[model samples]
Target chain A: MAGINEAKYMLGESVRMLKSGKVSNLISVIIMGFSLLVLVIYILVTLNVSIIIEKGMEEMCVYVYLEDGVNNSITEDIREKLLEIESVRRVVFVSKDKALEKFREQLGKNSDILEELGANPLPDAFRIQMKPESNASVAMEKIAQAATGWKGVDDVRYGKKWVEKGEKLVKGFYMTGLALGLIVFLSVIFVISNTVRLSILSRRESVEIMKLVGATNMYIQVPFIIEGAIQGIVSSLLAMALLWGVCSFAGRYLPGLGFFRFEGVIGFIILCAFLGSIGSFVAIRKFLKR
Target chain B: MLVYEIMPGEKRIIAGVYHLSKVLGRHFALQDINFQLANGEFVFLVGPSGAGKSTLLRMMYMDDIPDSGQVIMGAHVSTMMKRRNIPRLRRRIGIVFQDFRLIEDRNVFENVALAMKVAGIGITEIKHEMTNILTRVGLYHKRYEFPGALSGGEQQRVAIARAVANKPAVLLADEPTGNLDPMVTRGILELLFKINSGGTAVLMATHDVELVKSFGQRIIYLQDGKIVKDKEMLFRGNLRESISNSRVDHRAKKFTEHSIGEDYDGKRGR
Candidate 1:
């Protein structure tokens, strides 16, 4: 019963504080929301960039052109051998006629140029898609080298230089993304915690009076912590809402961009709430110790 | 209603200091101080400015621990006390300051109610009890007034109400009436006496010797971080036995002997 009464009083005190410091609280929440919005925007951009990169990686295929007049048995043997490579995900055989047909479709108005040639110039090839996990330059190079040595294989070709350059670019992007994310995360925490500290400092006199009146440290701290958690919830929701607005507005120009899933949104809100409470706890603890 | 561990053979001694000493910088703030406050006893701790009166009172409330010796307030022994238990100890012991120390933002009722709330009392109970506490302090009509809006004396009354709201076993007042006028000082002192009569021991520390001398209550005089006299012990002729320290007892006796012949009629002197 006493515990219940204490909890009631603490909650009431929290509400009273929130009401009394409405302007400051709102300002703090706004600042926090803006910071979180930056983080959300950064995260969304990274997410979309990674998705696009993955799609580009998946489109890269190694084409193994067969020697002239290769027989069906020889083509099957070459296909089986290509499938045996660890990096190879799938192998599809494309005959010369099919290749020429694709070339004509790609040419469109220029199909006459291809038709001018008496015989088909394209060769039957085994197009191998590398597994997404093994699509790095080294793995692509190894697969191409192995296929080039196979029988009935005239040439094995992939955009080896392009693959190497893309891998380096992707690696650099991820490294920069991680470093920037960490800075934004730390700065947001710093700003929020400092806001909590300032709020608590403003009420230092009240805390001292409470201590004098025999209020326990828990009694004094619970209200501030609750207020912090509330701030966190409000700011995070505001950030998410604002980010959604920005994404919607930007979607007109940049289509098919990804947003955080339901679970990620929920997880982020919970994390922010935890961060808020921990900040209050730390700030209040330092004051109380003195 | 928290259980208090009674030191063996001194059940009536609700609070006391035994050979307590505290050093501040190069000087001794308090040295080998010894005194006891019996249950419901209203004792005046009198001294001049910087005589360690506040320091002694602070030790009684466990705000500051003695560098040597011990202060025992019911179950709380300053030397053995845990940091977390300080609040629990404070709940059973009320402390008032000269500045009143009321929360300016809270009204009289809310200010007094804060004490009960900290003790985990329900809002219903606090609302029910605040009226009686305020009435006792003659401020029931000012329950809704903020501390800043009230006069110094009225603010002190509100502070007193908050201090005693928990029905503490001991109330420690440090210059509570110092900021009030003479008429207001008398009123505040009368309120304190009324509270003390309700079975709560009050140890009031003040720098004014003439002001407290007329009260006829037991008075302990501190000078230069030492007890010069203990009136009750002096009259009881057990100053030496009570303090048990020959040096402190000797000084108390010497001082008491020097002033034994002075007329101390409570009304005539004032």
Candidate 2:
């Protein structure tokens, strides 16, 4: 019962402080909201970029262009051999006529130029798709090596250079983002904690009087901690709301990113509450040294 | 009802200091001072401005811990005390400052009630106790007024009222009348005396030499972080000489009487 009463008084006191310091609290919320908004955008954009780049890498293929002297039996033998490789998911055999037909369909009205040549010069090719389990660069290398000296193969080609460079760029971006995220996380905590420290310092008289009167450390700390949590909660909601507004506005011009995921929204609120508790702890850490 | 009660035949020491020393940033604030205050005793801790009177009183209430000694109050002694036990120890003791230390935002009643509120006393109990203490301090009518609305004397009365609201076993006041004028000081002193009469051992540190000289109470004089005097006084003020001598100023006699007692009564000290 005594604990309940103390909690009630501390909460009331915290709310009173918040209400009295409106301008300062509002400014802090705005700054935190803006910072979090930037973080949200960075996270979502990186997530989408990573997904797109990874899908493109997964679809990478190695093409084995055939030598002109290759017969049907040789081409068939090469296709069967390519499929025997452990990393190969499937081997697609395209005859010269089939390749010409695909080119004609893609060129549309330019098919007349292709027909002017009378006979097709395009080579039969074997397209190799690697298992999803294999890394694009590794699978491409293995398949290129196995097919390079094959009886029907003239030239071995794959998009390994472009895909490898894309993978490196993505890995670098993720590493930099992780490092920057840590700095931003700590920076936000420091900024909020210092703000709370100044607020507590301004009320030094109250703290001294409370201590002199025999109020427990818990009694003194409860109000400040609750105040910090509330600030965190408020800023979180405000930042999310602002992000939602921006996302909705942008969604009209672009598609699919119009709303934040439910998990992201909930995670952000929890983060705010956690940060608030931490900020409060940092602010009042000095006074409770005894 | 939760007041720290002195059992009928318990030991009499309410607070004690033994070889207590305090150092602050390279300077010794108090050095090897020892004193014991018994139940219902009122002692005037007198010294010059830098004489460690405030430091001694602060140690009495555990606001300032000693550097190299023990401050024994009940079973909670310095250095042996746990962090969680400090507040419990404080609840049994009360302290008043030179500045009233009233919460400027809270009203007179709320300021006094805060003592009980912080203790987690029930609302009905707090209301009854606040009403009684405020009435005794003669500030019941100004209950709704903030500390800013009151004069220095009234503010000190609120400080006293708050300090004693919980019926603590000991009250350590550090110059409760330091900011008030002479007339206001008399009233505040009278009020303190009234509270002292109720069995709350009062230890007040003051630099008012005339007030100390005029009154006859236990005096613990301090100087240079040491106790120059710790003996009690049976009585002081020459009431008989003022009544017989024609050269004695009438205003001085009246001031003397008001400063001490109206009937010039004697208070024995041990």
Candidate 3:
């Protein structure tokens, strides 16, 4: 019962303190919101770029071309060998005629050029699709290398140069993203902690009075921590709102850009609230020790 | 450790300092300071500027620990008490400052009630207790006024009310009337006396020797980090005889006509 009463009093004190520093609190929230918005924007950009890269990877397939005049039995044997590979999910045989037809379709308005030179010059091929989990460039390279040495196979290609280069670029992006995310996370903590310190310094008199009157450190700090959490919630919500606005505006030029999921948004807000409490805890502990 | 084992009986000494020494920087801020305060006894800690009066009171409240020796307040010992227990000791003692350190943002009632609130008293009990305390300080009507709205004396009264809100055993005042006019000073002193009469010991520190001299309370004179004289202890070893509740006004009347410092020193020299 006493604990309940103390909690009620702490909450009342937090509300009272928040009300007293209305202008300063609003300014702090806005500044924190803008800072948090920078982080959200960075995250969204990274998320969308990764998604696009993943979609590109999903569409990629390794193609094994048979030698000219290869019989159906030879092609069937090659296809069976390709299907035996653990990474290969499905393999479809494209006949010479079907390959030529695909070439004409790809030419669209320029199909006349393709028809004039065609004596069904295209070779039969096996299009190998890997499982999503096994679609990494390294796995594709291994499959392509093994198939190139097979009998009756002219060449096995998975666009190795493009795939390897793209993989490198994606790796570099993730490395930079991780480093930048850490810096942004640390800066947010620093900003929030310093803001709380300033707020506490402004109310130093009240803290001193509370100490002199025999108030425990816990009693004094609970209210400030609550205020910090409220600040965190308000600032993060503002950040999310601003991010939505930015995403909407940017969507005109970059359609199909992914935003945060509902769970992810809720998680971000909760993480921010935790950060706020941690900032307050650090700041108040330092002040009280002095 | 063994000394802390001895507990005070009813009406016995409630606070004391024994061979207390504190060094600030290279110089000794307080050296070999010793005094004892009986229950319901009012004492003036008289000294000039830089005489370590504030330092001594701070140690009594366990705000600063002694470099050597110890301070005993109720059940807490400065050297032995844990840092976490300081607030508990503070709740048992009231402290008033010269600058009237009231929270400027809070009104008088809220300022006083904060003490109770921190102590985890229910709102109903706080309201009940606040009425009696504010009425005692003669600020019941002005409870809603902030500290800035109150005069120096009124602010000090509010501080005192807040300090004693927990009904502390002793009130430590470090030049509480330093900024007040003489007329206002007397009023503040009378209010302190009234609280003292109701069984709260007050140890008031001041540089104004003349003002506290005629009060006829036990006076501890400090100079350059040492106790030059402890009046009652020096001449009258029995503290009860010199500072009985009934003899306060009688002693005040007797000391009003003479300079007690000169008279006492002369007798000591002889």
Candidate 4:
């Protein structure tokens, strides 16, 4: 019963302290809001950029060339086998004559070179569209195994270097983004904790007097914790509002920048709320113990 | 109602300090002290500068725990009590420092009300009790005024009011009259006397021997962290003689409005 009353009294005092219109409270709230806003923007930009990179990677296609003198049945059998692999999304079989036609279309006035060749010298090829999520190394390995030792198969061709580099770049971006996000979050906590400590120091006299009058330690600590919590929640709300405004404005004016999505916005808002409350608790707890 | 009473015997000791010693770094604040105060007794602790008078008072209030020896209050030993029990022990004893130590942010009523609030009293009861105490301290009109706005005497009265608001069984006042005028000092001491008369034990530390000589029921003298003398005067002998001889002088002294600083220095120098 005493603990409950002390909690309520501390809460009341905390609210009273905040309501006193001290300059420290104003400064703390502003700093917290700004820090959290920066964090949210960083997360949103990183998430969108990652999505764009993934979409771009999905557009890359691989072409497998078949050798001359290969039987039609053998070519059809290879095509069937390629389609059996789960990574193969779609396979387009381009005949040698059709390949020559495509080459002529690309060359435009170079049709004479194709005619002089006199027999569709270009071999038939299977244009493979693998699933976007397929493991690059695994997909390439499966393709090589399928085409190796097959009749009339000349080579399996793909930009293996580009695929490997792209995957590495994507992973690097994720790690760097995570590290940066954590740094920003910790910096926010640091700033909030200092602000809270200053506020607590200024009210040290009141705390001493309270203690002298038989107030328990919990009674003295509660109000500061409540003040910190209020700062966290208010700052987070401000940050979310700012983020929503920016996202909405960008969506309206920047037509080419179609990267921003709303599916994760709710999750981001919840994250901000959690960060705000937890930051407050950490800051107040640290200040009170000191 | 039948009131069963026991036979008269030795006075019940409310607080006892045995060979109490407190050291702060290389310096000894209090050393080799032994004392006890009985229930419902008013005593004066007199000493010169650096005599550990305030330290002794602080130990009684459990503000600074002694480095050695035992401090027993009522049925509980101070050293054996847990940190959680300190507040409960403190609630039974009220302390009024020379600095007043009033919460400046709170008004007179709120300042006095805080004692009951910390004790977990209901708000309505606190309101009634606070009003009564504030009026008794003669600051009922300034209940809404902040401590900074009050005069030194009024502030001291508010401190006293706060100390008594919880009806503490023991009151330890460390130079309660240090910052007030002699007239105000008399009034404050009179208030303390009234509190003592109502069955609350008060142990006031001051260098004002004249004040103690005038009204102190019992006097304990200290010099260099050790008790020099302990005297019990039932307002007889020289106490009575001094009162009769200084009656006119006392009236003049009460009306003269001498500075407490001068009085404190004069008394301590003697």
Measured by TM-score, the strongest candidate is: 3
| C-alpha RMSD over true interface residues, model 3 | 0.9
Clashes of 1: 0
- Report the lDDT tens digits of candidate 3 across residue range A70-184: 8878888898988898988889999889998998899899899976784888888889887767747888888888998988999988888887787788889999999999999
The lDDT per prediction is 0.83, 0.76, 0.83, 0.73
Name the docking class for model 1: medium
Fill in the DockQ of model 4: 0.40
Any runs in candidate 2 off by more than 4 Å, and if so which? A65-112, A118-133, A149-155, A248-260, B1-11, B231-270
Measured against the true structure, the TM-scores of the candidates, in listed sequence, are 0.87, 0.83, 0.89, 0.79
In candidate 2 chain A, where is summed lDDT lowest over 10 consecutive residues? A1-10
lDDT of 3 by residue, B10-44 (tens): 24567889999999999999999888887667889
Q: Candidate 2 lDDT, tens digit per residue, A115-166?
A: 6889899998888877766777877888888789988799899887886896
Best by DockQ: 1
lDDT of 1 by residue, A77-166 (tens): 988887888888889989999999999999999899986798998899888888889856887788778878878999989998898888
Candidate 2 TM-score to native: 0.83
Worst 10 residues of 1 chain A by lDDT: A1-10
TM-score of chain A of each: 0.94, 0.79, 0.90, 0.73
Poorest 10 consecutive residues of model 4 chain B by lDDT?
B251-260
| Inter-residue clash pairs, candidate 4 | A67-A152
